[model samples]
Target: MLQIGLDAGGTSTRATVVTTDGECVGYARSSGGNPISSGKIGASSAILDAIESALTRANATLSDVSVIVAAMAGGSADDSRDWLIEPLADRDFTGTVAWESDLLATYFSGTFSSFGYAIVSGTGAAVIRVEDGQIARTSDGLGWLLGDAGSGFWIGHNVALAVMSDIDGRGPSTALTPRLLEALGISTEGARVQGRSPALPRLITALYDMRPVQLAQFAPLAFSEPEDAVSRGILESAGSLLAHSVEAVHTENGPLVIGGSVLAQTGRLAETFAARLAAQGIEPAIVRVADGAVGSAVLALREAGVDITASVFRRVTDSVARMR
Candidate 1:
């Protein structure tokens, strides 16, 4: 039997087909939009295209697939499961499907041996806690408007604020403002003003990239010297918010796993996060997921009837390594 796993992230949708033994058969990816904004029909079409591409790569048909598991941003326990069930029920695909938050899928796939916390920091940030094989608590997955601290959105938002302050002469004159202006090839503050007018939110988007951290170098800007104070403050705040999320669900002791592009690429944030957590007397095992997409695939297999054994874990890990 084959298991199909899909990870629907903020920027793209990824799908993978893996065998019961944990060998990856095929994988495909394509751009996808937020279902909450685009409507279910639009979201489903994008996901279906990705799934079809993956199965075609494996030289397999949907009929040959026995199970499906999807991990999506903004996907809930019920709505996520319905994507496959409702679609497959019409005979377009054939599978047993389950839906879960991407964080839960990643958490269950890794750290299966112990209770722990998982923090995902990418376009956004969210905290998940697993206890005795169940989700014990969660926090701040509310997206850009409400939560998602220490995320790309957060960094970008703060950078914008800092620049505005500098423009008004109310904030410290940092290297970021000039550096950003130069990067954008704008010679004067007038250009920045023009970009922010009611008609130009899109043009103003690049204004946030002035800070090194905002540039997503995640490293040199956050760790190296000559960094602006506002950038440092942003990093510290993000890490601290992540640490606080962990503490909210943590007991006296448990493992803490950090996942996503931001954490995986930047060691500075991890170090800062560890130090902050330690202040609360909690030391966490900070590790990046070798492959979150494949982790979702393993979750699909486990849900399909594979036993969670030492050998099974090794097989899943090996498959992810080979594919990633």
Candidate 2:
């Protein structure tokens, strides 16, 4: 028998088809599947499209699958399942279906352990404690406005604020100013030609016109010039906040899976987070994951009563990697 694993995230939806023995047979990706962002109808359509494409690649149908495990961004909400139920029913799916937060899928992607902690720092940030493949507790997944302290949005917002302050003669100058201006398609020379006085106002207008999360576009500027004191300070502060979030949910030593762009990438933020954890004597086996679809597949295998030995985990990872 075969199983399907689905990771329905804010940016994309991915589906993986795997045999009972953990070999990945097919995979496919589709557009964003977050109901909160894309609306239920759009998210469901994207998810179904990804699954159908993956099944087609595997030369199989839902009837050949024993189970499907979907790890979604807003999977815990009361109406979240509504995004999938009708679509799956229409496809004539008869197998068992399971739902979980994407956090769990990310964690299992890195390790087979049922107990561990997960830290995600992409456009938003969150930390969770996993017990028996479920979230036992969580911290700081409040989106770009209220929280997400160490996220890309947090870093980018700080970058924009720093640039504004610098332009207004209230903050120190840094390399990020020019870089951010270029990234925004704002000609610095034109701003200067139009008179430095109007530059700040123009920037304010541009910033206000964008969706708040679009601020995350400037996050990479922090790493562009690693020696800039202002950028360094921002990253350090972000790392501290992430460490604190991890501390809030972490209780014992188990694999600590860190994913998402900010924390998974090897750079200042990841280094600072590791240093802070070390300072607190909270070292655990650290696993980094770039995608959660494989983990979702592993969860589907587990639901089908397959034991996830180290060799089995390696088989799944190797097969998925080859497919990619």
Pick out the ten consecutive residues of candidate 2 with the lowest summed lDDT: 188-197
**Model 2, range 150-225, lDDT digits (tens) per residue?**
9999999999999998887789998888888777777544435444655676688899999999999888899676
- Candidates' TM-scores? 0.82, 0.94
Q: In candidate 1, what are the lDDT values of residues 35-120, reduced to their tens digit?
A: 76546676677778888888888899888999888777676544555544687677666567777677866675566554788888
* Candidate 2, residue 294: lDDT: 81
Highest-lDDT candidate: 2
Off by over 4 Å in 2: 187-196
* Cα deviation of 4, candidate 2, in Å: 0.8
For model 1, the local distance difference test gives: 0.68
Return the lDDT, model 1, position 175. Answer: 60
